[model samples]
Target: MRLNQPRIKPLSPEGLTPEQAEILAPLGGGGVIPAGPVLNIFRTMAHAPKALKAFLTWGNYILSRKNDLPPREREIVILRTGFLCKSGYEWTQHVEIGLRCGLTQDEIVMLKTGPDAGWSPADAALIRAADELNADYFISDATWAALLTYFSEKQAMDVVFTAGQYTQVSMMLNSFGVQLDSGQTLDPDLRKA
Candidate 1:
């Protein structure tokens, strides 16, 4: 939605090179890949197979239990970062993931207003961390302290890395013009932003 057209078009699975096909093979029908359009982000990233492969490693860790943050908490940071970055693609994709992670529709909407949107103290801390990381590239002492009260060192580290990772992802999706997958809807706030 940020751009009318994609700068880098998505690659179709049928058109993949042998090496790219091998890289994507594990992501097919019953592999670790999520059930949706594989050509969305993956196709675009396939232009650089090594980068995409490395990205998947870190991405899997972040979404896996190794990150320490609960799914809901992780979604809070992701949605907030996506919103702050004004990334329609990331925002649209994460809205569904967030809901599955236990965030309510209202909570999802409230993310656009940021940490001051009447979230619990802990949730607000997570959002504030995203905002700070986006705007300042560093978390403030107060935000860091608040986060310390609720998250372990690993969770705190995951919070920073997750925000940074998605921030990078937003830049990629926006710059490359990654569109929403099938059945995904763009948030009104994303459209306006």
Candidate 2:
């Protein structure tokens, strides 16, 4: 995505240390090492096994039903954040996840355009929140009010949480040069010159 190749190379599967294996284990199959190919993001993060473990714990919570934002809404924040960050790898990965969470392909394309792309009021607020968080690191009072109109207090919090989490993820994917996985294509808009 950001760089043509990884600045920090992913640990080769054949050469994983026990710590790496342990960290990567849960991401793939049930064993200490995965049965199949581990996703690129997980593999790259395995370089810091303890950190990856902690990251996964928090990530699990964010993706779980406990986050208050529904699955589709969460994906909207994530996709919008990824798009704003121009994180090609993050965008590629989450597009599929967003689709699974019930965002249509049209909605996915609309995410790239912004909050004004004919989104429903509730959806527009989510996108605006992500856009504000990315640009100002704070949602404006008007946008906050808009968010409150549609979301519960906890759901509003999750909106901020989801955007913050993906912002960090995008930074990592970009800075670490995490590439798209096998058969994944880079979004043309994200192509680096």
Candidate 3:
């Protein structure tokens, strides 16, 4: 919603080059990839096979349980980062993912109120981490301390990485003007961005 039109048009399924197809084949194998429609993120990224390949490697780790943050905690960071970055595509996609990961609709809505929304201390810490990272590019000592009280070193690191990765994704999706996939409704806040 940030741009009226895409800066670079997303590729259609028929438009993929063989090299792009080779790099993207694994996406189909993962249950994470939806069967009916390929997301515009994938279609657009396929334009650069090498970059897309490298992106998928880090992305897989972040989405996988190997990242140390539990799924709900991870979605907290992702949804907040996506919102802070004003990325409709990222936010909309994550809303679905967040629900499956155990975030209730009320909790997801409260993320917009940020770290001070009367959430459990641990959840507030996660939101504050994202907000601080988005605003300062570094977490403040207070937020870092709060985070340490509840998170292991690995989980803390995952928080930073998740925020950073999603920030980049937001930038890409916004600049690219990647539209929402079918059935996705843009959050009103994102629409106004």
Candidate 4:
């Protein structure tokens, strides 16, 4: 699949465009292009580009909201979603973000198989919920009840939003073939693990 570029790409940044740079300005003070473009490709099928842009804007709002879930828990959901979707771009990007949220090298490595990572009961349950939601579009009753023991109504809603939003990002990453930049690659050990 062709990525949205016409040049032999550099690795670290892949193909981030000026438009991408402009759109991602507020997120993490800007590093890589935000995932919006990849996500927007799908929206483009049925609407004008302007409307698609608006859709991505609101989607980013969902991602940017900082609710009760610490960065680590949130990143856990994102990381796993990326893996499931085989979204190398999203997975590589979140490996860094996941670390900032306090995931260690070993912990980040383990997130590819979050359920088997031997997380705390609550954390394990959260990962399970994410897997279920991604694979089936709805959380299982057992997982939902487990979540209730940890998160309040609003916080639970945010967790759902976080998972759903990142899953969308992952879908775009795969569909768009959004790869790591030319010189950049996902950590070798990470790729195999």
Candidate 5:
């Protein structure tokens, strides 16, 4: 773990209330997502007791399933959102997953900047939508309409949810200085301002 950073405090099942316990139990299961800062962050939400648990639980669902959108599209949305936030932790983690969902190294590289490096119309629209949402908490009607052709009603909602989740994640990672994986680096543009 990096010094002076938001390190993953170890996960222990003890001292948890039934409510928080039910919520946290799955996080400890490696099959779910492996024990890491991401899950640890969610676990810390338990600090707020029952009140914050609702938000935390809903967040886990939306972020993990995102069933409305296809994996490829959702991954694109997430990576672009992460890039817009200049979130090293988010970028490092998602870049690999994005590739698994068929995002090429070039596509992931293009995500670092404002959707201007010659992305396809749909891809460009996705990036622009995230930028718009980040700046305004809402996407432009034009971008929304453009995405409707490719994304379903549920997917449309998922796109926004996924974007919003990563935004929250990026803000936490950047402000908290969650270290990028040791010895691994992302694209230069992704690390660029």
Candidate 6:
């Protein structure tokens, strides 16, 4: 959504090189070669199979159960980071992911409003941590202390990891002009960006 057209066009099925196809194999297997519509992010990332593989490996950790933060809390940090980065594509994609992870639509909307939008103290700490990470590249001691009150040290570390990962994702999506996938509608707040 950052640009009218993608800076690097996502490869079509016919255009995929063998390496790209292998990277995208999980999406479609056997002889299908990307069976369904690939999300713009993945398809675009496929352009660099090695990098895409690396991205997915680290990304898997952040999204996997291995992460100390629960799924809902992870989504909160991701959504907050996407919003703070003004990444419309990220916001659109993760809005669904956030909802599936137990974040209400109202909470997603509230993320755009700021960190103190009536979230519980623990959730507020997570949001503030994302905000601080986005704005200052570091979370304050007070915010860290707030987070420790409700989450383990490892969970707190996951908070930074999740926020940092999504921050990088948002930057890539915005800079690359990775648009929303099919059936996605842009949030009005990000229409200008």
- Residue-wise C-alpha lDDT for candidate 6, range 51-158, written one tens digit per residue: 999998889889888899988899999998998888999888788778878999889989897778899999999999999999899999999999999999999999
What are the runs in model 6 whose C-alpha is more than 4 Å off? Answer: 28-36
Worst 10 residues of 3 by lDDT: 28-37
Q: Tens-digit lDDT track for model 3 on 11-116?
A: 8768788998887666643555556666778878888889998998899889998899999999999999999999999999999889989999999999999988
lDDT of 4 by residue, 1-193 (tens): 2244313222223444555544433432343243433322332221233444675675555556445676677777878777776666677777877887788898777777668678887778778888998889898888888888987767677678878888777665555455564345665533423
Once fitted onto the true fold, the runs of candidate 2 whose alpha carbons sit more than 4 angstroms away are 29-36
Q: Is candidate 1 or candidate 4 better by TM-score?
A: 1
lDDT for 115 (candidate 4):
83
* Residue pairs in clash, model 1: none
Question: What local lDDT score does residue 169 receive in model 1, on the 0 to 100 scale?
Answer: 92
Report the C-alpha lDDT of model 1 over 68-96, residue by residue, as the tens digit: 99999999999899989999998887887
Give per-residue CA lDDT, model 2, range 109-145, as digits (tens).
Answer: 9999999999999999999999999999999999999
Candidate 3 lDDT (Cα, whole model)? 0.89
Task: Return the TM-score for each candidate structure.
Answer: 0.94, 0.95, 0.95, 0.71, 0.72, 0.94
Candidate 6: worst 10 consecutive residues by lDDT? 27-36
> How big is the positional error of residue 132 in model 6, measured in Å on the Cα after superposition?
0.5
Number of backbone clashes in candidate 1: 0
Q: Would you list the rank order by lDDT, best first?
A: 2, 3, 1, 6, 5, 4
Off by over 4 Å in 5: 1-4, 7-25, 28-56, 64-66, 181-193
| Residues 1-193, model 5: lDDT tens digits | 1124554442346766787777666654353344543344555556555644666566657656635666777788888888777776677777777887788998777777667889887777778888899889998898899788666667777878889888887776665555555455755655544
Q: Which of 5 and 6 is the better model by lDDT?
A: 6
Model 4 residue 135 CA deviation in Å: 1.7
* Candidate number that wins on lDDT, 3 or 6: 3
lDDT: which is higher, 3 or 5? 3
Q: Can you list the residue pairs that collide in candidate 3? A: none
Question: What clash count goes with each model?
Answer: 0, 0, 0, 7, 0, 0
